[model samples]
Target: MSHMPTNIPDQSQIWNGPAGRAWVEAQSVLDDMFSGIAEYLTAQTRALGARQVLDVGCGAGATTMQIANVTERCVGVDVSEPLITLAQQRAVLADSPARFILDDAQVHDFENGAYDLIVSRFGVMFFNDPVAAFENLRRATRPGGALRLVVWRSATENAFLTTAERAVEHMLPDLSRRKDGAVGPFAFAEPGAISRMLERACWSRVRFEPVDFTASFVLEALELYMTRLGAVGLVYAELEPRLQAALVECLRQAYAPYTIDGRIRFTAACWVICADAEA
Candidate 1:
C-alpha cells in the first residue's frame, strides 16, 4: 500500500481501524440504508458528460461501481484500507472498470485537471481544514468540471441520527463539548458555512438543495443494529456490560417508534450540493 497522507490523526486512526473494518463488514447493510439518497444523487448526473469520474470517500465501491457503469474511467478513493480492500475485491469480482485506492482526498496528489465530474455520498465533511481540503479538490478538477456531494444537513434536521445521539447522550453524560470543526458526519451540517468554504476554494456555480428521503435500516433486532454501528459501538464498548445492556435497551425503545412494517425507517435529510470549477 502506498503512503496515504492524512492531516487528522484521530480520524485516520478511527477510519483505518474499527470504523473502516465495521464499514467493510456492514457494507451491504449500509448500501441498503443509504442507497435511496445515493441513487437519487446519481440520477441527477444524466445531463452531465462525465467520461472520467471520481468517487470521494467511496466505501466498498458501491458508488464507484455505479459510476463505472456509465463512465469510461472511474476511481474511488478512501482513507480506510479495509473498506478499500473490500471495494477492490468487489470491483474485481464484478469485473468492474472502477479502480479503488486507499488515500486521503484532503492531501492526495490527484492528477490535475483529470476528472470531469467528482461526486461523493455523505463524504467531504471529515476534513481537518475544510477550506484547504476543498482547495486541493478544486485543483484536481478540470476547468468547468462539476462536483456534487450529499451531506447530512444538521443533527436537528435528521431524526435517524439525532434519535440515536439523543438516546446515547441521555443515558451517558455529555463526554465533551463537541468542539467546532471536529471531523464527524455532521461536520458540514451548516449549509452557509460549507458554501463559504467552497467559495474560498474558488469553486463557482455552487448550489445546495435539500433532499429528504425515508432511510431504512434492516436488522433482525435492534441489538444487532446497535452492535453493527462503529462509533456508537465504540462508545458502548467503554461501559460495563450491565451499562451496555441498559444502553441497548434504551436505544431499542428510542428506535421502536421509527420501525415501520418491521423495518427501521426514519426521515433522513441532507444537502445535495453541486459546484463547478473555475472555467
Candidate 2:
C-alpha cells in the first residue's frame, strides 16, 4: 500500500471513512446511475486501441472492469480502502481481469510509459493539487497516449446532484459559498481553466465534449438516496432531528416537479474531456 500523502489528508479521511463505506453500500445504484457514461468511456477506450489502460479514482471498479473486457490489461487506482476492497471483491466475483490498488493517484509511484490510455468517470476532480496529480499520470502514460475523463459541468447544470444542497441552502448557508477552482467535483467545471491546468502538467491537445443525460431514481427511494449518498448526506447525520425532518420535507417538495410515474428524473450535465500525453 502506498503511504497517504499529507496534502490530501482530508480527502483520504473522507473516502476512507463514511464516504467510502457509503459508496461500497451503494455500489449497485451508483453503477446503474453511471452505466451510460461507463459504456461511453468503454467505447472511447476501444476506439483508442489501447492495450494497457489505467482508471484513476476507480470507485468500485465499474468502468475499470468494463475497460478490462476490451483491453489487455486494466488497473484501477483509488485512495479509498473500503471502495477498493469492494471493487476487488466484485472483480473476483465477475472473474474480471481488472486489478485495483488503494493508493492516491496524486503521488502514487506509477511506472513510466506503462499505459497507452487513462480514463476516469466523474473522478480526478478531488485532488488538492490537480496539476501535480495530472503530471504523475502523464509520467505513467506512453508517448502519444490518450486521456479521457467525464466531469460534472456545474452545480446548476447537474441539478440531479445539487437539488438537495439547494433545497436546504437556507439551513446550511455554506452550501451557497461555492466558487470556481475549488478542489471538489466542480473544480474542473471551467473548460479553459482545466485545459490550461492539463497543459501545465504536460498533457497536450486538450478538448471537451458535452454530455447530457437524465439520472432517474424510483420516487420511493429519493429521500433515502438524498440522506444517504448525496452531498447533503455528508452532514445529514449531525443535524438535529427537527432540522433533519425539515430538510427531508424540503427535498421532497423540491424534487416533486421532476417526479413522474413513481420515478424522479433530473438532468446530468458533464464534459467528456480528451487529451494526449506529450510525445
Candidate 3:
C-alpha cells in the first residue's frame, strides 16, 4: 500500500499539529456555528437513504458520521493526519463503519461510479483547483448520482465574523489589508463566481439555496475569541510577551456585546448547492 503525505509543511500541514489540535478542540464551537450549513446541504441532496457516500474534507468526520447513521457506508477524506487520527479513533469508539483516510480530495484516485453521493461542509472552497477537483468527484459518483455542497456567502453579511475579527484586527492591523483569498477562512463567496465554477466542473441542474443559521456560542468572551476568531492568536504571537496578555483582555471587551442570554448569537449566510452526476 502506498503511504499518504502525513508530514507536509506549510499552512496546509499546520492543520495537523498544535494548530490543528486547537481547531479540533473547538469542534463543538465549530459544529454549533456551522451545523446548519451541513444539514441544509444534506437535506437538499441526499438520496433518501444513500447506500454509499463520500465526504470530502471530512474534518474529524462529523458530517461523515451523520451520513453513515443514515446510509450504508461512508468514507471521509482529509489531508491532515491528526484530524484523520481523531476521526479514526472516534469511528472506533462510536463503532461506526465510517472509514477515515488521510488523503487530499483534490486529486485522490477512485473508481468510476464508486459512490452514490458526495457531500461537503464548507470544504469545496479550499481546493487549489476546484475545477479539476470536482471533475474527479464527478467520476467517483455513479451515473444519476447527486452532490451536496455548502459554502460561505460573503464576509460582509456575517456580522458575527466581522465583529469578532475586529477584536483581533485591533491587535494586528496587517490582517485588514490582507488579500481576501487563498489565506482567509473563505475564498469563494461571490454567488456568480460559484455558479461559474460549478458549470466549469460539469455539474448540471445546480441549485443554490441560500440558508441562514444562528450560531449559539456558549464560551466566554476570551475563550470564544481564541477558538472562533483565532486571528487574535496570530497577532498576539507577533507582539512582545508583555503585550499579548493585555491584547487578549482588550479583545474580550471588544466581543462583549455579542454575549447574551449566556450565549453569543451570531448569524451566517451559506449556500446549499445540489447537482447531478454526469452520464
- Report, for every candidate in turn, its global Cα lDDT versus the true structure: 0.77, 0.85, 0.69
Q: How close is candidate 1 to the true structure, as a TM-score?
A: 0.91
**Which lDDT tens digits does candidate 2 get at residues 1-279?**
332235333888889987888788778777877788889989998888999999999999999999999999999999999999999999999999999989999999999999999999877988877888999999999998999999889877776667787778888886543444566778788999899989988999999999896676677677767787756877888889999999898989888889988877667798999999867
Order the numbered candidates by TM-score, best leading: 2, 1, 3
TM-score of every prediction relative to native: 0.91, 0.92, 0.85
Cα RMSD of all models vs. native, in order, equals 3.7, 3.2, 4.6
Alpha-carbon deviation at 203 in model 1, angstroms: 0.6
Best by TM-score: 2
Candidate achieving higher TM-score, 1 or 3: 1
Q: For candidate 3, lDDT tens digit of each residue in 1-279?
A: 222223323545656655566656767677666676666545643544568789988887778876777777888888778778888888899898789768778778977899888888866665666677788888899987888877667777665566545665655667543223343445566656666767777877888777777666675533644633445544444578666666657766776777788877776776667788767
The sequence of per-residue lDDT tens digits that candidate 1 reaches over residues 1-82 is: 2222365546767888777877776787788888886677567555686888888889888888887887788899888889
Compare candidates 1 and 2 on lDDT and give the better one: 2
